[model samples]
Target: MSDPPKGPRVILEDDQPQIAPRLDFGWDQAVVPVVPPNPPSRWSGFGRAAAGVVVLGLGLGALEAANFTAAQFTRGAVQGWLTLGVVVAGFGLIASAGWAELRGLLSIRAVDRARAAFARGDLEAARSEALRWAGGMAEAAPLQPALRQVGSIAELRALLEAGPLAGLETQANALGRAAAVQAFAVTAISPSPGLDALVFAWRGVRLVRQVAALHGLRPGLAGTVALLRRTVFDAAAVAATDIAVDAAARALLSNKLLEQFAGEAAAGALAARRMLRLARVAAEACRITPPR
Candidate 1:
């Protein structure tokens, strides 16, 4: 029966609206937290104490020998005083070196603090830190007037970036390019793996030091080592993700012409890539503020 009116047929599809699947590569995830080092064990503490005692004992023995030797000199009293003066001077030099290293480390820490302050929008703290950082750069002198006019953290960063930082970046780029070329050439032509390793190490150290110096850092041996450690860790973390990309590019570029020198070309390219990465890392580490 045509019951009342044939109710309009209702159609229902089985599929619901599908949301585009979002791919999370973990890029937006919080950085992996660093595990704090274990506290020093009792044995470690005892070892350190024993080493200090041994050092003191050796120093005392050396002093006694030096005193006896001076006593036998023709001008015993004058010689003793001279020896004392020499010893004092040596200590003075050592103290000066230590102080320099400490200053360098503090300078690096100041850059870190300034970066953090600016990031948190603490304009007052940022201004103080910016001024302190600028004070160390002779190139920043002419930019002082403009810097004084900066009323915001962003403005301060902009001024520095367009001014002294720009020049420093240019110099750093040149240094990095030179180092990369040297690495490529050495790796391609080096006869022994040992020599290649030595050259790479030497160039890396020199490049890092030059970049650090360009950024107004006077990192001494200890400071340089610390900076190197940080740079290597950072660069390694970044490069790990890039290795597949680099390999793909290398494969695409391998042609008949390159095939003739394939081994050398691959080694050279890899070396250059690593050196460039190191240079970039070192430059970033020594920068007063994060790049825009």
Candidate 2:
């Protein structure tokens, strides 16, 4: 009988590990494209200014006629000039206010564009626009932070995917030195059944991280990723032949503390935090690291 097609498939035929994880790799534009939000036209401010000028001019003209005609007297050229200046001044004030609002509109457009890029899996584009939106907060003393952290997540994920590393993940950093070393594999030649199980789980956790980071999950979904990362590493640590690999992945995943970042608006931060912590501890049984 033939085996089912639903079985395992190798994503990459080449056994390339010397390359390491990509941290600086540019985003894959081939990934789905996100529809960017419309950018506000600079012309909007001009339109508002034009409208204000017309209205102010008309209003001031009417006032001048009313004052002169009601008193049955024509004002001198000096008075006429004074009235014209006042009308122009009023129009200027209105134009300035409209320009301010126009800035806000343009900013919102940038944010929308950023969000769209992220959805499309264009991480580079998303990160670029996200930084712009974040600057909106600085420009707007609006007493509110309207933009979501979705952009920030996208930027972070893109950085991690660049395929370069130095330190460790748990350190809230971009690199990690080798904490230890171990020899392990998934071949049938392995000595222990427990080792097979551990290898499978360890690989599984790495898969989860790869997928999660690829998607740029929001805080709501981050917990689920955390759950998977911690769980797989824990299992791998205990069941694998190499304790170092398990310990290192565990240390790295734990350091991110995605749960701890649950903010006042974080709906599931607490739950994620608790679950991630418990899962990391479960990895304790697999620990090969010396007491810290």
Q: Backbone clashes per model, in order? A: 0, 20
lDDT of 2 by residue, 190-275 (tens): 45657745654454444334322322221123343444544555544444533444355445555446433422113222222323
How much is 240 displaced in model 1, in angstroms?
3.3
Best by the lDDT measure: 1
In model 1, the Cα lDDT at residue 220 comes to 85
RMSD of candidates 1 onward, in order = 12.4, 24.6
CA-lDDT, candidates in order = 0.80, 0.41
**Which one is best on TM-score?**
1
The global Cα lDDT (0 to 1) of model 1 is: 0.80
TM-score, candidate number 1: 0.73
RMSD of 2: 24.6
TM-score of 2: 0.26
